[model samples]
Target chain A: MEYIQIANSTPMWIAAGVAIALVMFQALIFARKSYNTGKTIGMTDTQMKSAMKSAMITSVGPSLVILTGLLSLLVTVGGPMAWMRLSFIGSVMFELMAVGFGAEAVGVNLGAGDAMTQVAFASAVWTMILGSIGWIVFSTLTADKMASVQDRFLKGDTSLLKIIPVAAMLGSFGSLVSGHLVALNKNTVAAISGGLIMAIVVQLAEKKELKWLKEWGLAIALFGGMIVAAIL
Target chain B: MSDKRRVYEKDYLPYIVRYGKATGWLAVALSFGPAVVLAVIYGVLPPSAAVFAAFIAMASAVGINWFVEPISYFPIIGVAGTYLAFISGNISNLRIPAAAIAQKVAGVEPGTTEGNIVATLGMAVSVVINIAILTIGVFAGNSILVRLPEHILEAFDYLLPALFGAIFVQFALMRLKLAPIALGIALSLTLAVNAGWFNFLPGRPTYLITLGAVFGTIAIATSMHKREARRD
Candidate 1:
């Protein structure tokens, strides 16, 4: 069979579907367990329901972004592999580079017409699989250990424990924002606009105690900033 | 620890760890299974040399982040959330934000059992939503994207920057003083790198800059926190 035919084959779809189903199953299991745990911990059903609603709303913009990424990947890797990879461990940012490295190793430019052979495509798949396995391996081996590590770090000061995670988030996000802001392009504009928008929305939400504003703040900032940058 | 907290750590966490281990191994298999299937059907395996090169290239690019992310994000999302987020992908873009927003709206502080449960619920909902959108995108294929106006595609480019910016502000508001300090460190390092002032540093300076910002802010914040405690 031709490379393109194999890329979008029925068998590939089945394999991809099975992989996706496993992920969904894992998520459902975890969610159910956590929900039961929440009840034991004295969390109200209203809290759980509100959290689910807020999370669903928060996911819309990012999901749309992932969709954009999927569209781009589909053109290169076809529907099945792209769908499966993106749904499974392949982040939108990392998948392209993994595919690129694989294609380059086989002396082909990915997404170029007739350049990617069956061998090259196989190489790309292998690279994608191999490259991401480290995350699973490291996390599997060490995730349980983190609970103890956090415990040791806390040294009985639970308040300090909260600060550490909050600081980590701040630092990581600060660095990410800086990377985009340095470019002085539309990206920088978007970043600034988005930050400003979020600041305003958060302020309003806090001052008014508006649950809806807090829920929709990120999405509003993201789309609003993007629109503003595009216009400018 | 309180009896409830102890019970959680002793019983619930062990359960989470067990399930996490099982799911982690299963995820590894599922991730690799697709590549194996494609290789067998196509009657082509990537050459040893190609595999080696692709692995090295791809691994070098993401290796550090693979280790760093789980550690950084563990406290915010908890054990079960980490397992699911890492496997499902989109930790930063989708899962983390969803969890964060959910916890916030539910009025649960992160790093607690209730927080972890809320985060898990949020992540599960986000995962389902992401998969649904992706499946739609896959079935729709390129036609939807192909027919999109150029300006809309252009706007998509700003989405990530906007997202990072908004998320940064959310965290920054939590630590008003330290946030700017971290942002300043990252921004300065980013500028220096762009100016070719960091020629001596190996690889993209962005990684180093990010690390520096995170540690630097932590140091500053910790000292300030300690001083405030002493004063109190």
Candidate 2:
């Protein structure tokens, strides 16, 4: 059978499907648990639903952005693996590089179509699997401990407690921004343009009482950044 | 903290941690599904040497991040969220923005119990939504994606920077003063790295800038907030 045929085989689909289904099942369970817990914490019906709605909307653009990279993965690994991988821990760059490393090990260059032997494909798959295992292992071992650490912090003074999350978020975002602003490239334009757009839109929404605008802020900012990057 | 909040520490978080551990370990195991099938069923194993080479390459590139990134994201993501985000991945580009927007619209601050509930809930929603979109994009995407204008597809590249910029602003706007501080620290660190000051570091030291920016901003801003409170 052709390599692509096997790549898109029913068995591969089933393998991919089961992993994805587990993720979906876990998500549903967590979401429900959170909703029940939210009620106890004073997250009202309106707040819960609205947050979900806002998240749902916010996810659309980025999710679509994930999709835009799908073509590369599809050609590289076929539909099922691409679907499973991208839907889970796989980023486009990582997957591509892992595959390249795998193919290179077997002495293949990852050129267009049929250049990938079964052994090379196998190598790529193994590389991706073994390569990403550290995260899962490290996270599983330490997640509960990490949760405990958070517990200690939560018990700290109320005034300081409030400041930690806010400051952490600001710093996290600052680091993200610096990554893009490393040089004056399209990314810089996108970040600056997007930030400017977000500021304007948010201010306008607040002043004009445009609740819908507030909800759609991320989508608007993402698209605005994309447009500016494309233009400039 | 009030009794309402106490219930979170006493009742809610414990269950999430326990459940998260069980499911998180399960995900680690399940992540190996496709690779096993490719190896066992297809008899497509590569040479052990080739596999080792791939391992070296993969590890050299992103190994430290497998552990480092998750721990850094703990403050914003919370307990349940750490489980879900790490398992499902795409924490920055997709998950964080989703959770941030949800909390923003709902007017909940991160680090607090209520914020954790909302952030986790929001992230859970994002995981399901992301997979759903990818599912569709995989089966039907290629035909449609190929037909879309190249210019539009090119536009997708900019969404990430736009997202980072907009999200930083979203959180930065809340605290106001820390915005410039975080940005400045991140920029200096990034520039210093670019100038080869940190070449002695292993793998990619630029990655550590995210940590520095996050922890540095947290320390600086928390002190500022406390100092101002004392003055008041």
Candidate 3:
């Protein structure tokens, strides 16, 4: 009983302190920036609280999923390897969701991909790169069009006509390959192949204009990459 | 609506605000204390059994905090931080010296009791160290939370598809091109069916999944963009 009590009680306090510290630090930094810019935080205290709550809600489920998965996997596997693997998985999960939801938020045709394959380095790097590319390209080539889409999404009136294709494309290629590789215990190759596939697929899809078909082709290549990477 | 008129008034605060300070502290308390207790037990308990017990206790705390509602959210954060502390300690193998010091300072049994007074202090020290490192580690003019080394950063490059895939589900439901969606699915299925074939990559599953997501996103994005251009 004594042992159990100690194990359970102390960490909570410690974590709370850390969380508070983090929150405070970020808030202070932002506040300073706002002051220097001659602009106040737009939200009232109430609005701020609401926003935090909403963000917490949005982020909590995913965080829990990762936590539960991590704890279970840790217990079963135990040690640095498990930690590394779980970290990789968790990072991918968050990145994918951020992209998918972010695309819709902006009303762009930007899509998302698989949750599992995202554990590889390729997924993280490419998403950041492609996301940046999307930001630049859309802003340069179709600023008004993108803004219009963003307004529509913010108004809570998005059309399914635009989203399904995006999701499908995002889901199709490199993620599948990465997921397969990880499950097969080939973490490194998965990362490499996934990255390469992303570069190729993005470039090819952009040029071919047969995006849907290209997505399929990329998917096939991903699988083939796995076979070739794995067998050889 | 005037900027000057906006005072720090609270209209609707979260439960954290409503609960008062002590209650909030209690929430934090309940979540993290158990992990500390478990760490203390690691001393006396056999290595195998100790690890098992520690894991179970940690899981319970994590579970309770994670699945429960906003009312219980704070505790989860607290506990998660604590678990992180324990992991940090375990990985560092900081058991004996820390345990001895804890027993001396708190006048508690080293391996017995819940480590109510002593182990808590010891773990607290560990937490402080962990946080301090994280804090100072954040350099100016660069990422303040750069946890990954260069190698890991390199690894992150591969995870793009996986991240996007996870978000794909949450991508807004809108009018979408069925062709891209269909193609994406077809490709994913093919890869999954022949997952065994992709053994060549270093990171098999992660690679496969990342590959899938990258191509998937590209496929959809390009198709939709082209179609829209055609219409224009």
- Highest DockQ, which number? 2
Compose the digit string of candidate 3's lDDT tens values, residues B1-232. Answer: 3332132112111111232232233333332322232335333222333333333433332223222111111111122112222222221112112322233223233222212123323433433343333333221202322443555333333333332222222121122344345435545645664565655633223333433443455445556666876799
- Runs with alpha carbons beyond 4 Å of true place in candidate 1: A111-114, B196-202
Model 1 chain B weakest lDDT span, ten residues long: B201-210
DockQ of 2: 0.78
DockQ of candidate 1 compared with the true complex: 0.71
What is candidate 3's CAPRI-style docking category based on DockQ? Answer: incorrect
DockQ numbers for every candidate? Answer: 0.71, 0.78, 0.04
Q: Summarize candidate 1's per-residue lDDT along A158-194 as a digit string, tens digits.
A: 7666676667677777877887887889999999999
* Per-residue lDDT of candidate 2, residues A81-183 (tens digit): 8888887786899889999999999999875443988888888988888887777777767877886686576566566666777777777788888879886
Per-residue CA lDDT of model 2 for B40-78, tens digit only, reads: 778777999999999999998999888778888877787
Candidates 2 and 3 compared by lDDT, better number: 2
Point out the higher-scoring one by lDDT: 1 or 3. 1
CA displacement after TM-score superposition, residue B179 of candidate 3 (Å): 8.6
lDDT per model vs. reference: 0.82, 0.84, 0.31
